[model samples]
Target: MPNDTILVVDDSPTEQRVVVSALQAKGYRVITAADGDEAIEKAGREQPRLIVLDVVMPKKNGYQVCRQLKSAPETQHIKVLMLTTKNQDADKFWGMKQGADAYLTKPFASDELITNVTRLY
Candidate 1:
């Protein structure tokens, strides 16, 4: 079944709330993780349809978390979107290499985030 749940991961409380609010306003069932470790745990447990992950974070980081999630059979089916402040070409390439379904930098417009999330589904 298609899950409407979205996991938003970010270390910054302000950023997390902003993303969560935007997603919630669109009627997505939103959950949160303060860091990569929690994100992994929540993903496996919650099985959200999509994860909006931030690349720079305490421990694990987004790339590491995405790679692990993609490799793990239990959570591999979930789509990952790398949301980060790093906008460099190399950063994006690395995110894709880590098995991210899509990559979007921080300071993004709400519609842009929604568009990518919708595309993933």
Candidate 2:
């Protein structure tokens, strides 16, 4: 089995498109959520193997979503990668605190993204 399903949670349509396209091209089954709450719901339903999440979004934010997923037994095993423009150390620190497996700053290289995701798998 390919086992490449990835849930991408980001509010920006442009960012979503870029990330989703890159992952899909790498043979990932991409599912998108526009915000944190939707991410939670979809995560429950889709149970994707990985999640690429954005930090800033309406209604809950990626950190909160990652925390919920990591805290819950039903979702804790799923890997989470934080992909956001917030490059501050505090931001990355907080993302990790919320159980993100990896953090990638925005404007990231496509190859790097692929490498990181592949490594997680």
Best by lDDT: 1
Mind giving the per-residue lDDT tens digits that candidate 2 earns over 1-121? 1245899999999999999999989888898999999999988888888999999999999999999999998889899999999999999999999999999999999999999899886
TM-score of each: 0.96, 0.95
lDDT for each residue of candidate 1 in 7-86, tens digit (9 for 90 to 100) = 99999999999999988998889999999999999999999999999989998899999999999998999999999999
Worst 10 residues of 2 by lDDT: 1-10
Give candidate 1 misplaced runs (Cα > 4 Å). none
TM-score of 1: 0.96
Top candidate (TM-score): 1
Predictions in order: lDDT = 0.93, 0.92
